[model samples]
Target: MKTRSGKGNRVGLAVLGLVLLAVGGLAIARALGSFGDAAAREPVVDAGARSFAATTPWFWPVVAAVGIVIGLIGLAWLLALLRVDRPRRLRLESGTTGVTEVDAHPASEALAEQVSTYPEVRRAHAVLRGPSDDPHLDIGVSAEEPADLGALVTRLHDEAVPDLRTTLGLRRLPAMVRLNLTGGRRTRPVH
Candidate 1:
C-alpha cells in the first residue's frame, strides 16, 4: 500500500505542511506586530468576513461540510495503511497427482529463524507476498554492529535463498533482503 500511494501521500503532506506554515507564519507575524497589534488581538475572521458569513447562511454549513469531507478522506487513508494484501496460503504443487497447499506464514517464519541462526545475526524476519502459485519473499535481518556484512550477504545469496527455492519447489523465488546493524556493543574487560 505504501509503495503504491507513497508519492501521493508525500505530495499531500507537503501541500498541507506548506499551507499550515503559511497560516502559522501569518499568526506569528501578527503577534510580533508585523501586521499590527490590533490584528493580533482580533479574531481570525475579521469584521468583513464575519459580516459576510452572517449574511450568507450557507457559509458555516459549507465550512462544516468541507471539514467532514477532509476528516473522512483522512480516515480512509489511515484505514488503507492498516490493510494487508499478503497471501496466507501458498500452492506449492498442483500436479496431475494432487494439490499441495502450504501455510506461507509458518514457512516464512521458519526461513527467518534459519537466517537468524547465522553467525553474528541478532534478529530476522520474513514475509511472503503475491499470489499463491508464485510468491515473493521479503526478508529482514539485523546483525551485530561489528558483523561481516559482505560474508552475510554472500551467504544469503549462495546458501539461504537457493535452499528456500529448492524447499518450496520453485524454479525462481524472487527474494529481497533488508539488512540492519544492531546498536549493541559487546562488553570488554577494562584493563
Candidate 2:
C-alpha cells in the first residue's frame, strides 16, 4: 500500500523482464545458427543430462532444491503484483431499521471530481482507505502551470475536508493529498 513497496515491485518486474529478454534472445540466436547447418546443432538436454549423470546423486537433489526455491521466489513476486486492496464498506443508519451498506467508491469518486473542478487542477484521484467506520481519504492531484500551492492546500483543508466530512456523515476524516505539477514542453523564443 505504501509508495516504496509499489516501486520495489516495479523494480523486481523490470529485472525479471530484462533477464527473460536476454535468455529468449540467446535461444533465438542459437536456433537461427542451427538452421544453417544440421550437423552443428548440439543436443541441449543430452549434454546437460550427461554432465549431471557424472556428478554425485546428491548434486542433483541440491540443484532441484535450488530450482524450487527460485520458482517460489518468482511466485511470491507475482502474487505481490496481483494484490488488490479491498476497501471496507461504509455502514449507513436507516430509519429505526437495519443499517445499509454502501461501497465507498462512489463517495470517493464524487469528492475527487469536486477537487478536480478547481481552475488550477488538471487531474485528481481519490480512494477510501483504512477502516470503514473511520476511513482515510487518499487523494492525488496534478496542477497546471503557475498554480499557487498555498492556496490549493488551503482550499483542500477548508473546503474539501468539510464537504467530505459532512457528506459522508463523519466527524473527522484523515486525508493524504499529494500534489504534483503537470509537465509542459518549453517553446523556443525566436528573434
Candidate 3:
C-alpha cells in the first residue's frame, strides 16, 4: 500500500488547475463569439431563479450567509497552506542556559550553501522539518556527475551532517538526503 504524503494537495491543485483552465478557455471562446451573439444576451442566473430570489424576502440573506461561509472556508484553507510543521525560530536544548533559539530557514539555507560548495556536488538545498528536539534534515543535492554520487553521499553524511549538528548544538540529527546526478548528452550504444 502506498502512503499518502502530500497527495491530497497535489490532487486538489491538479483538479483546480483543470477547472480553471476550462473556465478560462470557455471565457476566451465566448469572447471570440464561439457561442454566438445570443450567449451575451442570456441572463446569468436564469429567469426562474432570479424571480424566486426577487420574491422571497429571506433569499438574499441566505445567499449572503452561504457566500460568507464559503469565504471563511477559503480563508481557512489559505492559512493551513501557509502554516509550518514547526516554529520558525527553534529553541535549542541548552544545558545550562536560560534560553536559546535558532532560525530554521537561515540555518537550512547556510547548510545548503555549504553543501553546494562540496566536491562533485553541483547544487544543494536543505529544509529543516519536524520539531527541534527530533528534527529531520531534508537535503537535496545535485551531483556534478553520476560517477561521483557514492563518494558525495558518503562525504555529505560523514562531514556535513556532524558539522550541522555542532552548529545546532544538538547531539543527533536524522538526515534524509536526496541525490540527483546531473546527466549530459547520452551517447548511442550500438547493439
Q: Which candidate number would show the highest TM-score if scored against the true structure?
A: 1
The pairs that clash in candidate 3 are none
Better of 1 and 3 by TM-score: 1
Whole-model lDDT, model 1: 0.89
lDDT of 3 by residue, 1-191 (tens): 11243677678889989999999998777766789887756655789998999999999999999999989987987887777675487678556657788898988899999998887677899998887666778899887655567778788889888888889888788999998878754689999
Among all candidates shown, the one with the greatest lDDT: 1
Model 1, position 67: C-alpha lDDT score = 100
What lDDT tens digits, residue by residue, belong to model 1 across residues 1-191?
45758788788889999999999998889888888888778788779988998999899999999999999999998887677767889898898999998898988888899999999999999998888898888999999888899999999889888888888888888999999998778589999
Q: TM-scores of all models?
A: 0.67, 0.55, 0.63
**Poorest 10 consecutive residues by lDDT, candidate 3:** 1-10
Clashes of each: 0, 0, 0
- Ordered by TM-score, highest first, the candidates read 1, 3, 2
TM-score of 3: 0.63
On lDDT, the stronger of 1 and 2 is 1
